[model samples]
Structures are given as structure tokens and as C-alpha cells.
Target: MASRSPRTTIFLLLLAVSLPFVCGCTDYGGQGVEQWSSDIPGGEAGDAVFNTPVQSAFTGEDESGTGFALQRIQPVMDGAAATEPRMFPVKFETREYEIDIDVNRSVYEGARTVDKALPAEYWYDEYRMLGYYSSFIGDPAIVTFLDDVLSPLERIRRSDNLNDEEFLELMVTFVQQIPYDSGAPVYPRYPVEVIYDGKGDCDEKSLLLLGMLSRAGYDAALLLFPEMHHATAGIRISTNGNPPFRTFTTSKNEKYFYIETTVPTYIGLYSENYEDAEAFVVPLGNGEKRFTRVNYVCHITESYQKIADRLVFMEATMAEWKQEIEDMKSDLQYGTYDTQDAWDDDYASYTALVGDYNSYVEKYRKYAEIYVYIRDRPYDIAGVYRRIENSNVMDITI
Candidate 1:
């Protein structure tokens, strides 16, 4: 698969039109409905944080107590170039890997101090400056840092004998494990700054993941959900066996599978909150690597969905059967029966209902076991397949 061209122009126009009116404040822990307007002239361009309204100027100190405001400010040149080696511990599945990188104080400060204002040409782009914010992923300074980060990951890949999909998941899980900075600046931070600060919001973390994946030779893009005021990373992977659960296609008809970076989630799984909202994909660099194990992931996702649906139906049926059995019992106790045969017939029917309910209970338990196994060992494709195959949950094979 080949990497596609950049769609900065189209992405900016979409951002301008989609996000006309936004709330002045946002709560990352909760999903707040944002007010939208289509009549606003020109675009309201702003930072990647998506919290502050375009009209509201940045103010107050961040949680770090930095004197800097959230608005676009001039870089404070301190002429410091000291480098500090830092270790970031990332946990994926049952294993924990420590990634070490040398952070340049000068680069980190420069990134923090860089101006975040959008160019004059963008119309109302300030509300979601995705095109502008994406530039940080390819910054010379950030690129250098990402190169160093990839070195250790490459070693881990060889040592663990991980396949392409597993390697990609490991890299993604690293970014997902980064502490989310609810009080981050309105502007998106450079990848270097995100690492040095040890935290980032959705946009900030997405940028970091994009850079890392791109540098590691994966065709990736940035997914912007303007309506939801959220962003996620996307990548081009082989969906040969089963279709992907969620993906955003560009005008050129290229599919980028959704990958949530702010929290730990399955690669192709998407959030239901923004599942109906429109999204735009901004392809990053041109890379050749593609995630080939999407078939395994799709099988697991499909089986999980089937098990969940069956469980729901079984629960509803059991509830109805229980109610019917209780009603028959009540009638037998309080209502008049014309004959003993009538009473015996009602009792037999009630007994049949009870038997059916018991049978469903056993089936439900079996399905639940399969569901839990897949949920817990999502990456263990063979194990999941064997568990499903051994039991009578459903006819699924990988």
C-alpha cells in the first residue's frame, strides 16, 4: 500500500465549516454537547485543545503554574541546550516496557514558546487548527526525537519477535499510556514537549502517535472529529480477511482505520459517541508499512459482537419467561380451575417454561465465558479462536 497525499487545504475548509460555534470551556472527563452554527462568516481558527472559544482570548496559568497564557505567544528564548535522558514506562497487555530518550531542553522550550496562531489566510480555522497543528508532527526537532524513540522500539521488536500488527499495537499503547493532561494548553504541543511534560490531551497525543508511526514506516493520518471536538490517529492496514469496524476514507478513496490514542482501545474499534459524526483524515508522511494482521483483529471483534448480541437476546427472553412462569403460578394458586385436568395442563406448561429458562441460563453462561475470554485476551487470536471453537458459542474460525 502507498501513502496518500496531504489534504491540508480540504481539511482546513472542513474545519471552518463544521465548527462554527464552540463552547468556551470543555470537560475532558465528560462529554458536553457543543453548540454549532453554520452562518458564521470566515473561519474561527484556534488551537487544538478545542475547549476555548475562538473569541475568548487565552488567560490564566495552566496547572503547571507557567506564566504563559494559552493564546499564541512569542517564544521566550533562554539560550539553554542541556539534554536530559528520561525513561517513559509503557504497559501493554501483561508486559511493561521502558522507553528511554534524550530530551533537549532547548528544543522542548522552543516548541513550548513557538507561536500557535494560524496564518491569516485560514478562515475561522482557529476553532480547530488541525492543518496548522499537524505541522508539529514533522518538525525537525520533533522528528529527531522520534527517530531516537524508534531505535528502542526496533530493538524490542527484534527481541520479542513481534509481527507488524503487534509492533504497531505496542507503539500505540505507549502513547495511550501517557497521562492525559486535562489542563493542557489550548495549543497542541510539539511531540518533544509532550514527552518532556509527560502528558497531553487528545490532539497532543494524536500528534505524538502520528509522528512515531510515520517514522516507523507506517502509512498514517490524523482523524479530526470537529463536531465531537476530539481527534484520533488513523492508519492504512490490510483488511483482507474481514472489513474494518471503523474507518474514514479520503477523496482519493483510501481507507484509514481509526485508532484512538487518548485511551487504551482496540486498533479498529471506534467510540460510539462520535460514530455518527463526520470526520476528516489528514495523511501524514509517505510510508510503506501496513498492519497485516487486521484479519485476526476483525475475527475477534466480530465474535465479540456476536456473543454480546446473543447475551442480550438471551437475557430478554429469560426475563419474559420468568414473568410468564410467575403469572401461571399465580393463576394456579388464586384462579378457579374448571377441572383437575385443566390445572395439570397449566402446571405442565409452567414446568416447560421453567425447563426452557434453565436451558437458556446454561447457554448464557457459556457465551459469557467466551465473551470474557475474548475481552481479556484480545491480542491472543489463537486462544480466542480455540475457546470459541471448543464451546458452542457460535460457528467462528480464524
Candidate 2:
């Protein structure tokens, strides 16, 4: 979730469209080039990858500029009982599911103890700070702490027999449902802190999602938009059937599909704002998990787009027909036709146009209904598939 102004409203006839249309294009802002060149220690522009070492103790780097060091923050325990479990209610299609995880009081306290300020030497470097942000994802303590929440998710996936893609959706939607709070600290919070507070901004939510995804064995990365000061999580999935909304290929040949966590959008859908912005992909882990349901989601995405286009086309056609009918009525009233036979012929043409216009109006209404159904229920893959399969958009004559 990159920091952005209020989104513009999208208008669709008969129904208000919320999600942005998929552009079906592949543009990775830059070809995975490091945009934060000036922020690096040596002032050299290099590929943005995690080269820092993970440690449990704070150690300053030597002035030789070899590598960066990150302090590992651990939760402080006062030997108290764990706090009450936080409950997250998730809705997938028509079924309602609940996930409950108990956060230890010390874990929340330890997260607060972690310092976000960069060293004085690199205080002015935002890229260095971004490196610090990336370190949290690989933090062993934080990764282990998130397991409490992950256990329930695994249980649900097994109990419901959800496939890889469905499970990915479940994990993503769960994070999306977390109330977005832009008021959170500018620096990213640990996943435990996000869970404890039950709210996070774009970076916070995106980090949490990437952590969970990596822990679940999915190849995930953090997408950084330096220009917009926004961040999003990207996952690598099979594209054999349908292409992703947008993608960035790393220097290592890994292709990551963009996933927006601020809003409850489908996996392959992202904001149009960052569609053209350059993104830096920071790989979290080398997990082998991949989503294989692109074909199913692709069908729903393509169908929704088709209906939307038809509605626009039909609306324009009807408007022209309506104007023609009005003009003919005016001519008849003014006796513009020289002979009675001419007037009769004009009147017949007008009547035929009016009938055709009315028929188009009826068909437009049906297409609109289908568009709204698919738009509103994007997560209902099976239901949307059925709705699209049962209705034929070609039947709506122009």
C-alpha cells in the first residue's frame, strides 16, 4: 500500500465500478534497477537486493563500507500471562471463517522496544532505511512470532481442502481485512505489532503479508516505489493460462506478480496509480510455493472486462438512436415532409428506430446486472464463472 491521495471514482453505467480494470501489460517501473542509488553507502547504483546480515545483537559496521549490520530486537518478558487472543473474522465467498491468535504481552512490548531511527551517518539515506525495513521480514524472532496466527490459517486450509491459490487468497484477504490506519508510525512495524494494534498503513500491511507468504513457502518479495513512497507485496505464480495484472522480473529470473494489501482486491489486481511507476523488488525468501489457479481468475477478469466494454458501446449506440427519433418527431410536427407518402415513410423509420432503441435499453440493463455481479463479487470465483458462463454478452445487439 503506497501512500497516495484519495483514489478517483470510476463510473460504470447501471453500476458503480470500484476495482481498476486490468491493463494486461507488463511494466516494472524500471528493469529491477536500484532507484535508491544515492542512499547506498558507496554512492554506487547497484541492484537492490538484501545483502545485510541478520543478527540477534546490534553491531556497527566498520568504516571500510563492506556491508551493513542490523540489531535483532527480542521481546522482554516480565513472567506474566499472555494477553487475550485477537480474533480475525474472514469471509471467503459465502462461508464465514474465524482465526484467533493469542499475543504474548512481552512480544508486543518487545516490538515497541525496537528502534526505527537510522544511524547518524545514514540518517539522510532513505534507501538504507528501506534496507532496514527489509531486514524485519527475515528477522527470525518476528518470523517465529507470527506462527501463532499462521497455525490457524494452516488448519483452515487443511480442513477446507483449499488449493494453493485459494489458500493464498485466504491469507491475502485476511491481511486486507485488517483496518488501514495511516496514522501508524512512518517506519514499518513488526508483524506482531500490526496484529496487536489491529491496524497498519500500506507498508505495515504489505510487510505483514510478505512475511506470512514467505513463511507459508510462497516466493514473495517487497515491491518498493521510491517515487510514490508506496510499497506492495509481490508473489511468483504460474502464468501459463492468463497473465498477471502487472509483474516485475528480478535479475535472478524470478517473476513476481503485484499484490495490493491495503484494499480487498483479488491477487492479480492492483491500483492504476502504480501501474506505470518503477518498482524495486526485494526478495524475502526462496520458497518454492507457487499459485497455479491463474486460468480460473483469468476467466473472471476477462469476462468482467468484456461486459464493461459492451455496456459502454451499447450506451453510445442508444444515445444516437434516441437523438435520431427526437429529430424525426420534430420534422413531423413542422410539416417538413413535402408529401403525405414521404411523411408516412419518415414516420415508419422513426417508429422502427424507437423500437430498436427500447430493445437495446432492455439488453443494456441485463448486461449491467452481470457487470455489477462480477464486479462486486470478485472473490466468488466459482459464482462469477457461472454467471459469466450462463449469460452471453453477444446477445446484447448494438
Candidate 3:
């Protein structure tokens, strides 16, 4: 139980790197922004415009001077997204709607050699496209953003008189408040960028939530629903509980509720459309992300219990040490021990107790941190992803 889980280790490395990003890079002030064209309202949700090549400024009739169309996409790794890269339930107030997202917009689909200076426009696309390009496996900048946000929440672990579920609720609320930017780029947002830019789409918000939750010591994951053309974040809870939204169960039988990081939605209350959709849950930064399917039966509360048990012991020990020191101070002031020899001996014992208290304080802090990282991890997940895997937004299905 003391050993760090692979996911936790990845988070630590990210956090270590993240230390620098506390003063985040603001404003992607590029030369020019790449404009995106998606169906506003009139265009068909499932139309061929997605497959239509985005004619570039570089393209023409030779002296018609247009560059040849780029081969932007190969087929996605899975056939689920063959028609569209992302789909989702739009209005949660209705609980009946799903948003059809066409990730057909590919600013950067593959590696390119810069023959000329390229163009300032492509550079801007590359900046917006950065989130899409990353799998978010142990990124330092992301971890740093997580560290800053979680530092405040970490106090909750030691704060007094709070229900076990209170922290989870607070975490969900914190993520829910993250501004949802519909106009941002199509792909996900890097965690730090979300903080600096003050907005993100579902995919971007999800990564931010994942980073914060991971640092705070919760078992967090990224859930992709291709059929709905949407992605959201979720945290591993102890049980499958009384039925509700979809849940991903690991090989060891841990259950996680699909929490929507975009909107402030309830944990188990998801859109009817997304309730039954197949979800591929990725535990960010855990090596070889093997997806665990949503299940209705069998779950484990060990992760919750493990953390609670450790905290209870540490808290109790901390209290006892504080009381001991206080009592010694009171005795010394009152002159309860008359003999000088007796007083000197008592003082020695008092100093040793103080040392013990300080040591445990530091020890518990570290233990809790590791506890968050390890227990919040998916157990026994393993597998290899394809060359071009669908992570945040769905890859356009050929």
C-alpha cells in the first residue's frame, strides 16, 4: 500500500516540472489566429462538409497557384468515430439533447517539414492545435497548474469537521466553475492554458479537472464518448452504488462516476443519451492506458477506505502529540515538579516530544500526497495505443 502507483509517479514528475508554470504563460499572442469553420446552425450535423478538404491559402490552379490539398487524416484507430470525431449532449437543462461535433477541422493532423518559413497562420493553428497533439501523459506544465490549484484544496484533507463526501463535492464544484469557452479551438486545452486563458471546451476543461483531481489525491480519468462527439472528466468513487449514469470499472473492480467537468452537473445524473454510450476511460499518465468499460456490477471501496484509515490515524496521533506538548508547558509554568533535577529531566522529555511531533507532521504530509496519487489510480490497467489514437476529441471517422 505504501508503494507509489505508476500514475502517482507520473503525477509527481509532472508536478516537479509544473513548479515553473505557477507563473503561467498568458495570451497566445501569435501573429495571426487560425479561423475555424464549423456548422453554426444551418449546416447539417452529419454532413459531407466534414470530409471536404479545407482549401488553404497556399492552394490554387498551379499559377492558379493553389497548393495541393494535404492528406490530413488516416482512419481513426477505432471504428466508433468513423462518422464523426466528437458527439455530445448539449443542453443539460433538458437532459435529452446531444451535440453533434464535427472534429473534421484538422489544422495539424501529422508531422510536417517546414520547407519555407511556413506561415504565421499555421503557427497559430499549431498553438491552438497543441492541446489536440498532446496525450497529456505526464506533462510538467499541466502538473504545475494542478499543483497550484490543489495546494488550496490540500488543506481540506487536514481541515476539521467535514464529511467524507464534502471534499469530492468541492472538487467537482471547483472544476464546474472553470469557464466553458465555446469559441476556443476544437481540441483539448493544456491544463495551465486553461487557467491562464480563463476558458476551455469540455476536452480542455476535462484535462484541467484531471490534473487537479490527480494532485489532490483522487482517482481521476478522462472519458471520451465518440458517438456523442464529447469528452468529460470523472473520478473513481468507492462503489457502483444505486444506478445512475455510466461508470468505468477497472480490472480490480473500482467504479468511477462520469463527472462532467464542463458543466456543474451532478455526479450520477448524466444526459440520457450519454447514460448508455460506451466510454473509453483513460487514467491520464498511467503507462499503457488500458480502458476499463462501464459496468453495473461489482466495485471496490478499498481506495476510499485506505485513504480514510491513514488520515484518521495520522490525525489522532497529531492531536495526542499537541496535547502532550501543551501539558508539559503547563507543568513547567506551574512549577509542578519542585526539584531542579526533576525539572531538567521533564524539559528534556518535552523537547523530544516536540521533535516527534514535527517529524510526524512532515511524515503525514508526504504520506497523504502519495496516498492521493496511488489510490486515485486505475488498478491493473495495461495496453498499447495506436499511432494516432483518439484521446480528447474524436478523430474523424473515414
Candidate 4:
């Protein structure tokens, strides 16, 4: 499909008006979610770890961190709506892939240097862990990292037949088997700790789950919130029925399910209180090329709309409006649009243009088509401007 156009004046206004509440402080950056199955190489193919009736080593501790419980996970709520499929695939040869490889070696190896595994200090700043993993997984540079590194590991685990809930339980069980290090302390623990000492912390546990999930061929993402970083994998949202979930397949005959690897919580457990936070996903299919935001919510309040309309009223007057577009065009042509600098520039220009209304609409009407051409998208603002420009009726106010 052709690229979507950038929002015209009206669209920009609408977007601003429709802005969702900014997520509370959280570092949400990581590779898209991946699911692994027994077909890959190491893990169980289609069995749930919890359902196997394995005895728990830790039980009965609550706030003081002394006990463990095998509480049955509650079923996930049927939320607002089924999510759309991933919009873009990780382009095999893009710059995203190269970045991820470097990130993998850096963080993966960096953790090994620390003497202790699963440090307490690192728990607070989950972003550091997220950055390291995101660098590897989400970066388009390491397109096949999920398949190459994680698949073989899952093959050995033989978790090929497990469903999402089962797989999550299995991961928790696997972690529970290894005790957290209480003697020594390290800032960041090594990935080797999972097998080396059979222990890991939040990031380590999450990564282990990520690796296994990737091998299973499931699409998932890492979620970073102010206080915690977690994982939320996708389950087919459209199907209807009790225990309705999408299945995972390894070979032609074998299949597994989605798992929530971060928490000890089982799969099939999500609700408004326990929700799916915003995440970035790497699509497995051949589709778009950008890292589309996932699980995002936008709410348009009347107050926001009023502000947006006023902004559009002013943006059209500045001669620099077209100049800004030209600059963006040049940057895009040379591939600088992805740079932080470019985003900053766009933010500045957009912010400045929307400061005044009458002048903004006047200029926008004259060049609405050209703006649409450059942006490759239309907007409510553009519609308004197009009408005003074509009709030459300048008596509208918001």
C-alpha cells in the first residue's frame, strides 16, 4: 500500500485534540514481542507448566517476601476492542538490524562482567534493562535475532505444545526453581545466571521469557511503566468463546499458546486494573516498515479540541510553514527523518504554526494540497482549509 499522508492542518488539529493522556513516566522501548514453540529446537511444544502439577518450592510469604503461592490466574477481561495486526515488519536490511546486534553484544556481555546475578539496585531503573534489550530486539538491525538465539533454546525446553497460560506458568516454575541471590549484590546480572546459577531478576526473567516466546513465533512487546517494565504478548483478539485464544504452531502438527513471561501470573489473565500497557511491536508479516506504537489509547476532550482549532487558525500565516515542509522533505530524502534532531524540529515547527488561528488557516488553505503531497496524509484541518480556500468564504471561527 502507498504511504499514508501526513495530517493536513485539520488532521493535525484533530490529532492534537485527540491526544491520549500521556503515559505516566515509563521507559517503553524494546524489540517487538516474539512467541516460541516446541517446533523450534529446545523447549516443550504444547504443555502448560502449571497444569503439569509441579510442586512449588516457595509458598506462603506475602509482603515481607517470605512466601510463594500458586494462586490460579484470573481470566483476562474482554477489553475495549480487538487490536489490529502488526502494521509493519522488521525490514531485513534496514539500519534497525545493525543497531540491535551491537546492542545485544554490549548488554549481553556487560552483564557477565558483574560478579553477582540479579542485583537489587538495578530494580528501580528498569529503563537501563529495557534500553539494553530494546537495543537488541526492537532494533530493525537484528531482524532474525529472535529466531536465531531464542528458537534453539525453546527447542531444548520442549515447550512446543503449551498454550499461552501454560507457557507462562512453565516460565514461572522455571524461575521459581532458581532462588534469587540473597548473599551477593550486582548492578546488572548476566544472562548466564539463568543456567549458571539458575537465578535472575526482573530483566533477566523477562529476557528469558522473551527468548522463549520469540522461538515460539508469537508477536509480543516489552512494556515500560514508571515503576515497572513488563511484557504483554498478543492473543488473537477477535475470536469469541470461553477460553477463546489464538494458538501457536511449531511444525505442521504441533502448536503452543501465548504466555505472559514477566510476572509469575499465568496466561489468560488481564483486566482494566491489570491491563496491557503501551508497547512497541515488530511485525512478523510483510507490511509497513516503521515501528508502529501498540496498545495506545487516545481520548479527545472538548478542551483539547478548542485548543487545536485555535492553533490551526494561526499556523497558515507563517511563510516559514512551507519552508519547514521543504526542510523536512530534504531530510527525508537523505534519510534524516529518523534522527532525534528531525523529530525535535518537526515538533518545534508544528508547535509554532498552531499558535495562531486566522493566519494559520489562511496560509493553510492556499497550500493545503501541497502540504498534503509532502505529508502524504489528509486531515480535518485540511478539509476546512480546502473548503475555505476554494470557496473564498473567510467568515469561519472556532
Candidate 5:
């Protein structure tokens, strides 16, 4: 849900092809390295393996540094629902080669207008930490927290034999399960603190999950929804994936699949408020931070097909219901309906069918409206899945 940047990062295309779906991870689990290739045109991305920790970055001792001095404060698990401070690896893969990153001991929290006087460090989209050599500021504390979060799940993930595509879903589910607390003190909490605190608001949770994705080697970025006071992560995903959502192109034009971290969801799914909200894409120094576009269609073909199927079924059902009602009315009007008991039974059935028909009509109307919306909206297909997934769940009504 992150947004609100002085700059506009929206790339408008009324309809673009769906991003490629994540493929199976094969045997890349355990210690084997997985190499990735460039799916987007401009980037020369190839081979990235998260098999080993970026050990060297956290190794060196810093006597003095120019960057912001940050100490890993032991976070207090004040609430009973805290995550108990455990680490779980983010499981994903790219078909590229290995790339090295140097984690700077002193990380710079880039130049953003900071009202030093403000009591709560309400992080805004303007405060995108400098993402250079210090791509992810490495602190022993943050590293350990990440490990704690990721380690416990290694066995379970391995046991499930999850592929990269499947792994992304699992990873997102893990982040969503974290309890949310809006009362995080003003300052931005390190991934460690967020984990220890157990509850995190949108921005805090987004960073913690982003750190995990960085450690696990999936390409991810920051999405600031400033106007909405929300933050979300955008992960690198193939344009052809089944995640019925759209992506945002970085200033460099590299597309990152939008994901909602504060709430548990598959990548590219988000709130209705941001359905057409302009997302500010903050780069994480992952090569090709600039989004790339290939003159594509955005909405899922399968989604459209499903809608068509439903439309056909609804139309057929509506016709049958109408016919039944018409026949029942004709019999009564012609006085050929026989007994009062028969009349009562027929009336009741007619009423029930009327209700059903009305429901179908409303549903079909929504489907058609969504179809038109998807056809014309720029870079937003998330509603297709959101509506489809949550559509039929009913509430009790007399």
C-alpha cells in the first residue's frame, strides 16, 4: 500500500498482456544455485542465487563511518501476540547467475525532508533510504532477525518441495500471518524490531518482508502509497504469471509485480483505493530497477475467459428461471392451475426463482462492468482476482 512521491512513476497502458507466471523451481532447493535470465528487454540480468548469506558485508568492524549510526536495540515483545522472533527464508528463484552485494555497516537513510521535531517518525515515500552499495544496510541484529524469521521454515519448505512459483505464494502468506499493530512508535523499526514487536503497520511490515525477499534473492522494491498512508513491496515477476494484477515501471522502466505485504495476499493484489492509484516505485538497487515494458496486454486471458463462461451460464440460468415463472403465471391466469395447494406451491417456487434470477442479474451486471473496467483501465488487473476470489462469499440476509 506504499505511495506518495513527488515524482510520478506510473506507466499507462490501457491493456497490457499478463506478466509471465512463476515457473517450478526444480531442484534449486538446499545448496544448489539457480541462475536467472533477463525477462525484460533492457536489463542484462542473469544468474542470481540466494544460496549463501552475503557474509562479508556483516563481517568487517567499523571504527568510524560517514553514514547514519544505528545500533541494534533489543526489541521488547510488549504484546502477547509477538512473532516470538523466528526467521524463515523467502523461497524464490531466477534463471540468472550469482551477483555479490556489499552490505555497508553504516547505512544511509537518504536525504528526505525530515521534521526532526516530529515525535513519531512517520515514514513517508520521500524517505526512500539510499539504495547504493548499502542496498540493504547490514547490521548483525537485522541479519540475525532475518535468519530467525527464515530458518524455522527451511525444513517445512523443503518437505513441501515448493517450486519458485509456489514459493512466492507461501512467502506472501508468511508475511500476511504476522500480526499488525498500528501503534509502532514514530521511527521506522528495523526488520528485527518489527519481528520482535509482533505487530506492524503497513510500512513497517513492508520493510520487514522486503528484507526477507532481499535475503532470499527474489527481486523486490518499495511501493509508497503516500496519499493513502500505506506501504507495499513490489517483487520481480514474469508478466505471464496467473496473479491477476498489474505492475509499475521504475524510472528505469523495469516492471515490478505489486504485492500487498501488510495483509496476506498473492503478489499484485491490493486495496480498491489503489486500484488506479499512482504507485511511486523506489528502487532497491536490484539491476533493472528501471521497469521495462514490451508493448503488452495487462489483464489475464484466463480471467476474461472465466468471465465469459460465467456470463454464458448466468444467461442460460436466467432464461430458464424466466421461462418457469412465465409458465407458472400463464397457468394461473388461464385458471388451469388446479387446487389452491398447487397454487401456493407454484407461487413459492416462483418467488424463490425470482430471487435467484435477481441475484444472477446483479452478478452479471458486475461482471460486465468489471470487464469494461479492465478493458480500459491503465495497468490494473488486480480487481479481476480480488472480485473473483471474494465474490461468492455471502452474508446472512433474511
Candidate 6:
């Protein structure tokens, strides 16, 4: 028996694959790639394909150069155990592509300071790398830690004329109190490290200050400098102040102050060394004591939609091949052996088909994640996609 060439086998497989999905010789799968349609049952009109029960879990990758853990606050049912819950799948199409956010404005009033003492646990756990990123720990514990240690600072909060010079003085005093260590453990020890040892780093001081200001009812954000590996938190300046340091006032017009959490006051805002750093600001959510702005955070979701779509398409193709092989086997049992040569030819063809099927199966089995990038900000979809695909997932910060 003679085997058919690989070209012939692939040609037949292609033909078998093309006949079913092709409608009038047109392809709907590859047209300008439509946004997720939200026209599914129980969905709003003109909505794109919407995924419900968005799984909120952390994923870490330490690929030498790339690593990041995807983190988000997900809704949890009361009295329910800690497990992945089921969600709905909604589909829709879009004429003009845009993400619809259901903003809850009723919750956010003006930012106010939480007058309670900062809890030492929240502050410690936030800086302590050991259980810092663990989901088991709640926000209250960390908040409490901040309150316990920074209580003194919060108590001293008064309605003062917070001018540029006064604000700089406060910043210098705070920085001078805390020590900076570049080699600190990834996790923070909080007041234990700062109070007892009188030492910490940019992130630690920032957290301490953040907890204090928030408790005092001042609106602030954790300003991140990724390139410089630093964090500085301060109130958002409402008006222009001095040239270097911007000033954002709190909910109380009288209580306005500028904060530089990382560096000592000696290195003023004009310190040219930290100029042009990559910076991002995350506004704190206003709770009972703290002032949280409505829709302050961006909704960023990363979907492996590209890889998922590819898997779906390939699986559909494999099913077609499997059906063909089954039909061929049926023919063999029915005494439809056209020739000995054809039988031998089918062996290699079946083998190659099996190989391709197994390869796709393996790919589908691997750790392919669908990152749904959601942010409260109007982000560039194309740019976001490019960053996720090109850079290490850890480098992706919403």
C-alpha cells in the first residue's frame, strides 16, 4: 500500500474544514473584530458580549523578567463560602465601540477624614511581604494597623492655614522621622519597623501617611512611581501653589496640605533627581469616615479573549476532523475498502491529524489567562491590549 503525500492530506482536511462554517463563501469570524456584544437574554439593548461573575483571583508569574499578580475587589454573597461562584454570560454588538460603566454615585459624597485611631495590623500587613498579598487578610485589619500607629498624627489635625511653606515643613519633619532602606523586605513591618527601629522605605512612609490623612478626613491618592520604585501619597491639589509641589485641598477648605511621603524635606520638591518619573495616582475609595469620590477608580479588565477565540476556532476545526475520521472508520467496517494503497495512505493521514489535534489540546490545557482590563478611566483599548501582550503581566498596573 502507498501513502498519500502530506500536501494531499492537508488539502482534504482543509476542504472538510471549509465546507461547514463558510456561508456563501463569506467569513464572519475575521471582520474588523467586533466588540463584545451585550444583546444576550436579560441584557440591555446595544450591549456587547458581557461576561458576568467576573472571576476575581490573583495570578503570579516569576518568569525572570516578568511577574504581576492580578488583583481586584469582587462582590461576595453574605454567608457564602470562599469559592468561585457561577455567573451569567451576556452577548451584544456595537456600532460605536465604548465600555459602559454602571456608576454608583449615590455612595460617594465628599472625602472626609476617619477620626478613629489607625490599626497597627493594616499598616504592618500592607508592608510585611509575608502575608501582605494574601486574600485571607481583610482591609479592616490593614486599616486598623494604620490607625493605631498614625493616631497621634491624626489627633493633631487642626484647621490651619496650610500654605506651601507650612506643608513643606510638615513633609520634611515626617520624612526625617522615618528612615529609608532600599533593601527592605518586600513586605512591610509597619510601626514595628518605623517606631522601634526608626527605619522604613518610600512605600512604608506613604502607607503610614495615607492611613493618617484618610483618618483625618483628607482626600488623597497613592501616587506610584514605577520606574523609580517608589510611592508618595498626598491630597489632590485644587489650585496651583508653589512651582515644584502641587497642593490639593481636603474636603475641609481650611485643611489643605501638600505631602511628599518618600524623600526627606532637605530634598525639596525641586529635587531634580526624581524628575520625569513614571507616575500614576490611585484615589482612595470614600467610606464612612473617609471621603471617596464616585467613580474614582478606573475599571481595567484583561481578557485572554484573543487566545480564547483562537482555542474555540481550533477546537471547532478539530471536531470536524474527528467526524471525518469516524466516517472513514465506518466505511472500513462496511467493506468499502476501495484499495489496499488507500488504506495505507489513510494511516499517515490519520497520524498527522491526531498530532495536530493533540497539539491544540495541549495548548488549551496550558495556563492561558483571560485578563479583563477594566479601569474607571477612559483608556485606549488598543494601547492596553498592546501593553498586556508585549510586556510581562506583572508590569501591567491599572
Best by lDDT: 2
* Cα lDDT of model 2 by residue, 54-111, tens digit: 2211133324554343455577887788675788887776688887877767867887
Per-residue lDDT of 354 in model 1: 84
> Could you give the candidate ranking by lDDT, starting with the highest?
2, 1, 5, 3, 6, 4
Q: How close is candidate 2 to the true structure, as a TM-score?
A: 0.74
Candidate 4: tens digits of C-alpha lDDT, residues 174-237:
4323444433232323333333344554444454545434434343333333323333333222
On the 0 to 100 scale, the lDDT of residue 90 in model 1 is 78
Q: Of the candidates shown, which would achieve the greatest TM-score relative to the real structure?
A: 2
After superposing candidate 6, which stretches have Cα over 4 Å from the reference? Answer: 1-138, 154-172, 186-192, 240-258, 266-270, 287-398
Candidate 6 overall lDDT versus native: 0.33
Residue 12 lDDT in model 5?
Answer: 19
| Candidates by TM-score, descending order | 2, 1, 5, 3, 6, 4
**Model 2 accuracy (lDDT, Cα):** 0.64
Better of 3 and 4 by lDDT: 3
Q: Put down candidate 3 lDDT per residue, 168-212, tens digits, no spaces.
A: 555555555566776765334444445545566656666566554
**What is the clash count for each candidate, in the order shown?**
11, 2, 19, 77, 61, 67
In model 3, what lDDT does residue 84 have? 30
The CA lDDT at 17 in model 1 is 24
lDDT of each: 0.60, 0.64, 0.41, 0.32, 0.44, 0.33
TM-score per candidate, chains pooled: 0.66, 0.74, 0.38, 0.29, 0.49, 0.32
Give the Å shift of residue 251 in candidate 6: 20
lDDT string for model 6 (86-173, tens) is: 2112111111111121211111110011111222333222222112221111133233333443332322222344333233234334
Error of 1 at 61 (Å): 28
